[model samples]
Target: MAKSLLFIPDISGFTKFVQTTEVAHSQHVIAELLEVLIEANTEELQLAEVEGDALFFYREGELLSQEKLLAQIENMFTAFTGHLKLLEKNRICPCKACATAPKLELKIVAHCGDIEFLEVQGNRKPFGKQVIEAHRLLKNSVESDNYVLISKELSSDIELPIYYYSKVFRFKQGKDTYDQKEVEYIYSIIDSNKLNISEYSKAKEVVFDKPPGIVFDRNFAIPAESLLEYITNLSYRHLWVHGVDKFEYTENEVTRLGSEHICVINNKHLNFVAVKKKVKPGKYVYGEMTRSIPIADTLYQFYTISPISENSCSLKIELYWETKSILKKLLITLFAKKVLMKNTKTGLDLLFKLTEDSRSIPSSK
Candidate 1:
């Protein structure tokens, strides 16, 4: 896997989008438009076709080293914009679909030095290391018509010296029963990796439904207060290791429940820290990875406690990426899905086992 990669999500149902609008076959036009954009982008970014509408790009073999890398990404985006201008929409006949449907948007995320190849093939190119995390970042991006958001890592490395401007927006997708996460979005799809078939396979298995939620009503009785705090605090500490550490709550929830909620924050490194800023958490929060994370599918969450009366405290959590598989769920007999199931079960066990040591302490305070 390449340490860094770029991601671009094109609209999937262009034909449907065109039917309601004045445009005739807007999808065709959009396809051609993107093809032209990529033509110019390839050389400008020093990128090679990875597959689909994504690519692997870097400045030769030399390390990006922050400032130089930022310049290259900005230049790539600038070239991309220039390509769009050359293929000016005004030059083409404005069809109903083009007029009605929102202008095409690209949510871009860029990162560096995290590349790896899961598989090697004679004809097929390899995947970059940052594919999973990069895509996760891309999904969290706000869908601006044409915007760019850099990761904290990228932001630190690249100065982004360009006439263009980029703003950081926190993104959360899915609501209600679905989980949401804080993310940054951008218009330029400048990460080092593009869409990969293997990634899609792994991603398709994500189970989006029945995630841990914003409000939890867990009840485990007859546990000692210190042990309870020990488990809760220990889990809280674990969540800080990976991103997704924002939290909010109204009342206690564990065994006894509480009167109000408490919010906890984490620093950039995912270490527990004070939340100087305030933000509400989603309803479906992902649970944390206490032990080793699952290999099949994975999700994460974080909760905080106020410790009022040492009885119960409120919990707030943020959901991380999720994986589900309709086919995998149905194909139990298939050897592949079976292996996936086993790994998933093992992953869940590892997560739960982290709390086993604290179980003897009795009522978790």
Candidate 2:
């Protein structure tokens, strides 16, 4: 048996918060906050499991200094509060979950004792009385909603000032009563200011009104480079796109960044212009387009090509455009989405067939 520290950082007011908030948004907030807490793990700490709204962590071998252990606890508290404030300030949704996210708080319990490690089904399982004691400490009579509770068993090993801020509690456990003096460190009394968010200071940025309307994905039995060439080069686009009679460049240039093409689809004229945004060769191409339709001022489009093997790749096309009027939104939701989905599916199928054919000619150099 070896000595180690057992830690459980749990969220307070979780049940009440969830009950008073929207289901989907509350679930998202909980997940995000949990992720933020888990990201505070240090090399000295080992994450054991995420037990619902709490994170169970422990470190084996030599005991950590009291100063270092307290510092880690403070770090987690600060992270939790910082993320909570950021979400509170940035949330635009009017749901109760988004509006009351800042009300959530964190509390942690720490203890140290002997534990024997065992491997069961390729997973490490820590078995000891200390583990059970640490969990029981979570239900202690600490009056503060957000505070750190360290058991007297572990505090005895640390040379820290505990007499100034300690509390004693007696509770029953499994037909047996136990008494232990614990230390409480209130969070708000330490430093109760909101953290400066310099990295995410967006004061004058236009947010998109809505997400993408349709997303289509497929795997092609061909190289990404070859498929990208077929998609980008207008000389080859007319062969795969249905009802496209011609695609001629306006400036006598090829289809590329800042390039424009005049397309006649079944005698209905439309102009297509490209403004390259972010391009990762053989991986993805993201750009904006201005067309003849009134589907917002510009449409956002991206093609993500993920290579599965040396000769096969996956393609995901995302289309995003906003409708201004309520009638337009209703039309898009009721009818336009189906039409767009069908057209997108047809285009991808044609591209797949054309790319798979051995006789398909390469774009001219």
Candidate 3:
């Protein structure tokens, strides 16, 4: 029988990241990275399981050629770092999870050997000594967190050289003893600059020439970052924003620039995309734009949070609308503006009350 391949791409620093930052946001960040790595798989490897911060994949019949295997590793690293860069550049949240996400790293381990299969309640999985060895190799004496390690057995089988040097990879020999047995491997520390990361869409920062048509301000007895999260996180929208039949968004995704959500009201879907604008240095802003409102061709709403003290902040809500039709403009000037102001004020009042009531509740770490 042909040898099988065992591949694992683990997110380094995940434990520290989750323990030190906001739990919900950190989980979202890790989930996004894991999905990115899974999408980067080009060799058609079977996904065995998602082992928390890592993914276990196997190829049953054959191992990829040395060149193809190296390319696959590089592709995953590129995709992983590219997304970290995107998060760093496009983030709008001031929370620690969003601010420090770029500090995360990735390491991959690859091994090859003949494997046995076991069926567990209609699920087939690879098993045997090879799987154990592959996982043990993850605890090697590698100096860096960003790297690729190929077991000596697999490297020899695929004809990968001991001192393989490439633009992005420079392999060095390493070994460690596990369970009274020695395992050898070749490792390469990946340089982010050496890889060609793909480009992503940037956050759109719109410039406005006129003042907002409606503006309201309220002071909250919460920190600025916490207030920002409560407003930007669509999951909490239903509790504070009334008259919306439903709120739809990517539940596992962190709210960032270009992120979109839908507000279903009276059977009509209003699509809103996250946006940003210039604000004072000490203030944080979250803005959204929608074209679904009938009174105006375009509508924009911005929430600016300013820290007053360590435990208190003030929120300023601004509304802006634009239309080319004279009738629509007259209607907004005469009728819609008042209605918008009333609804916005009511929402803010509800939001204020919700925050006060939930102040004693322990938030997820």
Candidate 4:
């Protein structure tokens, strides 16, 4: 006997989507959507086979990290919706399937239990009651078309974030009278919108008392939306930001207006503190270096992005410093400007590289 994690990501509204839509084009859309889902599979997960409208994936060994699994699920959802949007935009056929395919939704059901693999004709297939239970869970009582339901048994083994709220459901098994213990299952509705897969904070337009001390601009070969996600989403931001030591988010933070973070940066073994200003999504992000005993409130940074083409965009950043101090203003003009330009250029190049790599993935359009 082996204990393993069993999960299925099932597509909802798929039957209706295909039935009324053009068969040839609808099949292409389904195949494209499934390919995107399969690409999200990590090395930790072993994919068994593709069921009609869902993919069967499992990981045998220790319990998988809930956070990583949750991220993968969210990533797949983003990809799914993104490609669907492309299909909708580029559709030429006035068929029902192409028109309604964007309405398809996804849900995941996960569980952990004893499992055994049976080899028939050299193909590996999972079998046992636990496997059946995992499949049965797909036909759940969840009202939402989009959700992730982890069995209460597996949920207990791993601690989910505080944001996830769960509900109890008593599923009647084919009119069989049984105790509540047999039918009772607790699951959580994954609020995809609440999850900050790609978020940034900003107002309509950032205002400064005067002109910035330094500015840098460059074009990137990625869409503004992808660049926005890279900049706004802290999870993705940390991967590329240089000298990031740690970050402290505001209480129950999810990257919105009035949300703040104390970003600690390591500069040649010395730690400096910077505070993120309130961010409005899709506009701009501003931050300032906080005053320590030795550091002054002089340094500030602002970011703004604009679209260039269907697959490209322009990024602009301005660094400002207090010019009230005559001596400090002279010092920055003579020396600091060069250094700021070099560092800002390097960071933007790295950002461009990251966004370009992100766009390399296969998309519907």
My TM-score estimates for the predictions, one after another, are 0.34, 0.51, 0.96, 0.48
Give lDDT tens digits, candidate 1, residues 1-365: 22344434233334455566534235444555455445635324444343343444443323355445444444444444443333342221223443443344443455544554443453333355444555455444243434344555554444433233333222222211113544332234332222111211111112344543233323232122332344343334333222335544311222111112233334422222111112234211112331122322443433332233333333333333344765533443345444433544443344334345444432211
In order, candidate lDDTs are: 0.37, 0.66, 0.93, 0.62
**Candidate 3 local Cα displacement, residue 172, angstroms:** 1.6
TM-score of 4: 0.48
Highest-scoring model, lDDT: 3
Q: Which tens-of-lDDT digit does each residue in 159-262 have in candidate 2?
A: 54454331222111111224654433322222335332234432222235565678989998876655665676567777777767887663222233445677
Q: Between candidates 2 and 3, name the one with more favorable lDDT.
A: 3
Error of 1 at 174 (Å): 18
lDDT by residue (127-159, candidate 4, tens digit) is: 888788888877766677877777766766777
TM-score ranking of the models? 3, 2, 4, 1
Lowest summed lDDT over 10 consecutive residues: which window, candidate 3? 356-365
lDDT of candidate 3 over 7-42, digit per residue (tens): 999999999998998888899999999999999999
For model 2, the superposed segments whose C-alpha errors exceed 4 Å read 163-191, 194-200, 203-365
Candidate 4 clashes between residue pairs 3 or more apart in a chain or in different chains: 21-97, 199-232, 201-279, 201-280, 202-279, 202-280
Tell me the TM-score of model 1.
Answer: 0.34
